[model samples]
Target: MNNAKRRIDLVLLPIVLLAAILNGYGIWNDQYANSYYTTAVGSMLRNFHNFFYASLDSAGSVTVDKPPVVFWIQTAFAYVFGLHGWSVILPQVLAGIGSVLLIYFMVKPTFGLAAARISALAMATVPVVAAVSRTNNIDSMLVFTLLLGSWFLFKGTKQGSPWRILVAFALIGLAFNMKMLQAYMILPAFYIFYMLAFQAKWRKKIILLIGSTAVLAVVSLSWAVTVDSIPESQRPYIGSSETNSVLELAFGYNGLSRLTGQQNRAAGAGMPNAADDRNNRDNASASVQGSGQTGNSAPSGNPSDDVGMGEMGRGMNGMNFPQGGQMPNGGEMPNGRDFGGGNGGGMGGMFGTGEKGLLRLFQTELSGQASWLLPTVLLGCIALFAGLRRRNITMKHKEAAFWLIWLLPVGAFFSVAGFFHQYYLIMLAPPIAALTGAGFVAMWKAYRERNGWQAWLLPLSVMFTTIFGWYIMQVYNDTIGAGWSISELIAGFLMTIILIVMLNSSHPWKQGMVIAGFMVMLIGPVYWAFTPITYGGNSMIPAAGPTGSNGMFGGMGMGGRQGNGNVGMTPPNASGDADQSFPSSSSDESDVDNSGTGTPPASGGNMFGGGGMGAAGGRGGAGSRNEEVDTTTLNYLREHNTGETYLFATTDYNQAAPYIIDENEAVITLGGFSGSDPVYTTEELEELVQSGQVKYFMVGGMGGRGGNSDISNWIVEHGTEIPTSEWTTGTDSGAGFGGQSTLYEVKL
Candidate 1:
């Protein structure tokens, strides 16, 4: 019997892992997330592994927003493939898939095969899980590294492998570098409780504690030195301390300042998160601790006073509060992020006037900020249930409680930090999934004890059926649209019926239920892979990209609206309006100290910022360089001497498009977008053309910003016909436009 079980485990492990991988495949078909470009891709380009590839800043300082451990994978790819989109993001997708597999491995002993399989399947199809798994971002890396570290510790304790403890601690170090200290949340607490519960011997205890600490210090501190060695100027700060530079910006203040209001930057259009975080920290600390971070101010007479009772003080007791003036009627927010002025304090106006000078507290607080506590309450219930059946639960749980305990901290950490993004809590979903799967088995047995199987089976399965329907309609709607064919519809219904017939019964029934669920969802997801994707559940890929740099990812059916009321994608190059200016700056490090002797590279300015090539910018004179390049592209542009320039359009509507990688194959879909997708902005086109930099412009579906104002007014006004012979902007050498786009060129 034991040999047969071992054989079965070996066979099923590969099958399950392969399926998890397939779940992430085709996720990069469109731009779906933001970090793909800024943090993830930037890391790939700047670091060629060997610690620090080259600093991005021209002054040559260490860039330290994120730890280098995660970037190591991204840079390794960049070293060979040259910082293309696909290569940078692929690692994230694999890591996400790997995390799912790890969850299954961790929970299998406690939950039994049927429950473990169901949990993995649920995780694979859960909408947020599926969406995040496909992007090039650190959140997935954070989760994977955390789980890897947990599995090592849990398995090591059970298997008596001390080496595994060192490895787990090392992973925690890597996770710290990937996403700050959030990686270490479970350690001290988990260790203390585990030791007390398991009754550790002194030698074993010292080895686990001391050796793990040493491993952590070595792995984590190395990145600290490499990052801290950087100078101050290259760092980004509306106003954060240097001891608190981008390093603090990325990890500490970067994450916590937003919630605590250290940076006064508010959430909204025109307001970067920096201001709310930078300023609010002082304000919030003042409000909560009385005087300031120095711990001055007097204690409040009432523990539930205004600021104390209101949104700002919600986290003092591990609560989440609404930001700004919330709806009086207790309405839910559209997005988890609060886009208002008064910071994370709920109903900003209600508490008092929007006073930067004083911290005013309100009596009533809403529920969002405190959302992290939901899992704790859930764990409490689970613990109570397990305690009732302590004998049954103990032997059935190989390491189930360990995983449950580990999963609980992510929420506690978020709650204490007071930073709340609904989906950021998606990190908690895997464990919840594991718990629920295991819980169902335990619940089913209890239910059967009361009602002899048949009575409970139909209702329980129906409940799952209802949950899946909700997921399809709301969560997975991007893939499985409102439209369901007869075959899919019938299969879905039949599967539900089969589950109803089998639920709450023993293993045979559970096996049948799973097989039916797998067949139904597994096939439905494959269909979602090829269809036109949506953004926030609206529109196809934009003709124009999103607002600002590295804004929204993925294709929306209609072009995305910009924050400045530019309706539909990135504004085109053709703009007479100075209100809409290019992101150009004298400060772009790419331009400083660069001296190219020959014809300048496609980039408009010299490689480094200071001094110009030739007469002003490069070694070659301005007029002698090739004049046939495109000016419409983002990220890079090649300059020509004849007053004409070309844009390869590297940053498509959203830079989700691919660069001209040789052989035209994507390394990874950064946000799952090819970046080659056709997109344009009339504002960008007109502005460059009028300035004489844009002799020709590439026009496609991307030019919908400000609601056709550029094309209807500016492009139509400034553009005129010229013969092909004189049209050196290459209007005739037309590039094929794809995905609801039209290409056009202008003559100067």
Candidate 2:
């Protein structure tokens, strides 16, 4: 028996390590929606505090929406890898791995081996969980801390030990330190629900509950207390004042404003009426409407409703600029201009003033945000009552009561949010994973009675279906968010129906349903992730027009500089405009600058020019000039025979330097000659390829800011833009005349 148990342990340990290893691996470029710098910056800032009690305030402030736990994690990486990319995120990868192991162990004791394994695998690959791992945020780590808290709480109750209580409280505190109160609320809420529903011994439950709550209060409050005790200058940017302000914003202005045309989060974008109504009335607003607590509607003759065009005139829709509001002449407003108040003149009130009364009301209504889990949170509260009242609590029910209480506190915290993202769903999964795993284990006799041998079909079907479900969900999410093709949507829909049918049919149909479901869900994601089908076969490259107008920089940023684009998913440009595709970003010069050539400086990193975004990186002011491309670009020429990278050739800071330096990745300017200037001859451009120095001659097309049509004539004369004679040419490409841009690659 001992040897058999040892052999089983050997197999299990490897599985746990493998899952954790994959969980901790590096995130790709797109998972962050192409924004790794935010976490990198946050890590650097908090890492500063990890060393000393110092105040930091200067040179353009940056703060994330959450707390310092994530920063601390990255700070650890900073200690190991220095403050930069990939390394700082390595710890999270480990936490992710740890989470998988924790899930397996937490469930294993309750659910038995099979269910625990499936639970581990299930949490590891779920779309949202996958996203959290790939992101540079706190969700994954929070999931870890929550898992730890839940496990130890279960242990304490089961073993009649206070050490486990300390561990649980410590985990709660760590989670609180990580992302503020969300973890605190989310976990405890779930624990309470489990306790009340099952544990009948009220008095002992009460004692354990109070003991755990007291323990949690002490554990979680230590950091806040320590930070609070510090002098102002010492821990300047490191506490929870903004947390309340943001909650006010979320529940007050951002929340209340959404009811009418007031707090539109996407205020300026001018979503189509249909989409806007659907978004506003469909998901968020619908709940408010159902509750019958929605506020007053905007009056027809309200002056703010009569708002004009320009900055102030920017209607409730935000896309609307004020008519006579700002610049009377209709041009740029002064620097740091405030669109304060509303459409008329008073502050547009995005986040209204934080009156205590209003915040209370907001918090009250906002309590319903996590309504789904509140009742459960309450039950765990009762279970705590039973534990505390006990004299001799040696039963399994008493132990389950402990886990129920611990988890409830954390779960209820996030449930209070007005909105929930996939990351928010993180807290729920671990407990559910454990519950599902363990519940299935405890109810084996029952499930066998309820499902019998057919019960075996349950997991097999869910596994196969979940794999399928993941694909369909990806296509649906990617397409909707990224706007993929009509044909792609049709294919996705068809596959979804097949999977739905397979899952819903009777017993005999289960096998066929599972198989067919798997095939359909597998289709789009696999093809998109792996194939050259190009953004779901819609030609990531735009179709050519009859006017023979090739687009800017061949076919690069037009695909997307963020989100889906970074993931090789090209954005849609239905308006015939190159700019309005995927993830609406401010054409902020910084975005254009960073997206173009110059490398982003390392933390606290000032640029060295050629397009550096350091303190003097040509970001602001009237006409500053400190841009420089990478020094590597000067010598980083690559072999083109294998043809891997794309290039944009330019010089003259005032001309193409900012845009091309990072965007096209300048290697060498082709002909028209000068250092970093257009210099290579067609033959020289070709020779650079032979020398493994250049692959593209990145020249000018119309709308290109500087330079000439010579590069254009050059491209047409020597290269091909896209494939297919009919659709490839800029002219006679059918009815879509003057509708597209052309990009020519020199075959040389």
Score each candidate by Cα lDDT.
0.36, 0.34
- Summed over model 2, clashes come to 98
What TM-score would each prediction reach against the true structure?
Answer: 0.54, 0.47
User: In model 2, which regions exceed 4 Å deviation?
Assistant: 1-65, 188-205, 225-417, 435-748
Error of 2 at 546 (Å): 32
**lDDT for each residue of candidate 2 in 1-748, tens digit (9 for 90 to 100):** 9888865755456656644433443333221111222222322443354323211111011222234566556656656754333444456667767887787776666546765774565455432344344334566677788778867766765565656756776788778766556565545443553354324367766676677677777766665566556554333332112122334322332233322333222111221343343333233222322322121111011011111122122222211111213221222111122223221122212111111221221221111111222222232233223334446543334434444444444444333322222134445556544444443333332323344443333334334333333333333344344333343445445544553444434566544543343333333322322211122100111111111000111111222121222221112212222221111111100111112111222211111001111111122100112122223322332323255333433211112232232333323222111111122234544554455443443322111111112333444456554332322222211110001123244554
Tens digit of per-residue lDDT, candidate 1, span 381-500: 343255445456453453555546666566454443333222244466566556645655554444445444433433344344333333333433333344543344556667656655
Which numbered prediction scores highest in lDDT against the true structure?
Answer: 1
| Model 2: per-residue Cα lDDT at residue 16 | 62
Residue 459, model 2: lDDT of 36
